[model samples]
Target: MNESAPQADMAEQLAASSFNTASRAIVIGGSMAGLLAAKVLSGHYEEVVIIERDEFQERPANRPGVPQDHHPHRLQDLGKGILEALFPGWREDLLAQGAYEREGKEMHLISPLAALQFPYEKDEGCSRPLLEWVIRRRVAAEPRIQVLQGHVAVSLLTKKAGSKLAVSGVEVRKQRSGGSRDLEAALVVDASGRYTRLPEWLEELGFGKPVAEILHTRLAYSTRYYRIPDSLKDRYSTVLIEGDPSLAEGSGVFSPIEGGVAETTIYGAGGHYPPVDPERYERAAAKLIHPMLAEIIAQLEPVGNPRGFRVSECRLNQYGEMPEWPSGLLAIGDSVCNFDPIYGQGISVAAAEAMEMGKALRKAAKENGPIREHELQRRFGRIILPAWWTIVVADLRWPGVTYEGSLSGRGIRFCQEYLDIVRRQALQGGDMELFGLLMGVQGLDAPPSSLFGEEAVRMVVSRSKQDAWLEKQLEAGETLGDFLERSFPVFHPASHSEANR
Candidate 1:
């Protein structure tokens, strides 16, 4: 048998089809990442196909593919902006579906040290199912995109292109019936998420497996829904109580979702898992740093039993580090870098990546050449770096949490200490500028380096004497600001004035 016969046949079939193969793209998975990817690809491709393993309903509801859908999820301001650009009136659509808008003042952040209220332009309080369903609906309306639910992408079909393997299409299998078929495309995106088999698929094609960076957080979440009491309905819409690592207590979030119900999720790291039992869960909530979360939980009417989800580790597949990558293949969202759910960074990060993908596609179209998959992967690495580092620094503070990656423990510890001082100063001094910057960084709206401005450095350095490591770093030959700029050079450092704005 001819080795190139399969590739030749696929090419012939694509040429004979109505649409051009060069203008077709396939996205694996139908979740947030996949749906967003399809939306972006629709602008560049004539036909965009989404292969999803789980069947989706016309209405919003939890699905098996997204186990954490029942838990509370947040869309950061940055993500909201991108979604609005992709799907006009996105927030309005969410509002029409019972989601309420939450202003900065309506949200509260309480920690053991202090309580701070930061300013945010706007955010929506909604369930993960509602968010995904809204975006999926927008994507479904795009004539160029076709979502094929209950279909699993089993493997990638590749053909040799020069010295590299070019992904020609995807081999998909029907989830319900034991049937399979090949869907040829000019590009293949692996947005199948954290459990993605892209690494295995690449290895099968003789490409060495990408290095995996793991952070074993051992985080657990127990969430229970409640009906907002009439009296409490006028209270704050969202409250987040920061977990104390010293006491091994997890964070708690109380936010209103659709259907006039509020979901409270209590999460802890390093095996400090929240309980699923009603009584035990309330007890755990009572032990939070602040009593506000517990007080609210007591007044709300319990809607459902407490449900739990556990994350053993967060993984980032370093595909860009590979010496050579397939020409026509790319990965996005969890398939690239999966974040800790506790941070609520997954959906926002996916939306941001989709926007970047769109820009890359537009550039490729202007140049009239194939998209540089390797360079695009490197760009995504840059995008994921700050978010990855932010979570790494926080998770490392937990007792049993450990990381295996290029980041050093010393650097992580230094960042943690620096952030602690900043938080204290922001809250105690009532520095809304500093607090807003902190929130912006955490929300993935601003670069992590935004927290290292001159003003922030001065504030942190003044209190650095307590920590020996920070003292040593401050006393080094280079300026404290310069040291941070060199130490964690993920994003360009923001100026104090720029950060304040």
Candidate 2:
């Protein structure tokens, strides 16, 4: 055989061998979701390639892909636990890098009527970039996982097998070289985040795109970083300075970050946008849902000019409604659902989804005959929907936010009743464990049902009359729903839709 003929035959044979290896998978996007997907796929697939359109950094730093990386991030205790389970000793790695293990920062859960500071039994958090970078490094160390940086996934390669659409592989293009290559794999995962083009691609292939449920609460965020003075590090702990939702203002959090620095992010809901200047940042902080944030910001040094970001509420991809989904393909993370970051639950939910994906993939592998791709997608959706409801519903209660769902009348009353309990409990300072538990559930450590349990509801009712602070606030004309409607009309559907709807 001539040199050219033999080489062509070898290439064809290799391509054939690549399909059934039972050890190869391709993942699109090298984000937190993508990296976590690779870690989960490491045990199941012998080799996993993560393709990214952005340049990959050896160290964890800010990049164009994740615009919100610079903002404050709180890895709820549940999220911390999930990461610990995923990468053993991950927390220790963070602690070693000057990431504070906050334990005694009393949580102040606020409502229009009252702000209750509870001595939390357990709570912790860290910077967003530091946490993402740490996890990315651990994932990259896996021998089976290889990150193909600066590459874009042009399209997914699928074939019709009998009556099923089987995902055979992916077509990718290298950014620097402008060269194209096709890689065959047993599975392909889409973790391309909120800007994912998967739905559009599916439409091009004749598959109907999944409908999106959007909660449009026109919100804007401005964030600035500060170096925490050594003396204030221990005394100055995490504080969730909030905006009075009833007042048409956004909420903010001032917390300790990874590099011995503090970060404050102020968000405005509806049309109450925070100006990208120091004076407006302070004014917004002072007038937030609670006024304590103003006191905290007054003591900090400005590390950088504030950066602004605007968001149009939350988005949930109803993948479960798809008529037909190809086997061996999965969507994860922000591509699956994106929640309002103000709730501080995004990281934890992502971790929870990753854990679920790992379990589903393992079960599929054990069955050996066929993969339950639809079931896997359903399982992922099940994990996301509850969190989505919590966030979208909360935003919808405000003046400026709008959504497709019915949130007026009885819905508004139900939310008001729930906040009534939240206000009372926050005033009495008697439900730290419960508050922590709710945070975990919101963070995806537990279910939403945990928040509305008989015990929690009873506690709210019992404390409603007894909370002096709440009673006083109510007497002073501060009701939860009224306060929210007045302060955050942007998140309130009726306020934005009355004229246009």
> Highest TM-score, which number?
1
Q: How well does each candidate superpose onto the true structure, as a TM-score? A: 0.91, 0.83
Cα deviation of 374, candidate 2, in Å: 0.7
lDDT of 2: 0.69
In the predicted model 1, the residue pairs found to clash are none
Identify the runs in model 1 with alpha carbons over 4 angstroms from their true place. 1-18, 117-121, 453-456, 459-470, 474-482, 492-501
User: Candidate 2: which stretches are off by over 4 Å?
Assistant: 1-21, 105-111, 118-125, 289-291, 405-409, 426-437, 453-501
Error of 1 at 17 (Å): 5.1
Q: What is the clash count for each candidate, in the order shown?
A: 0, 27
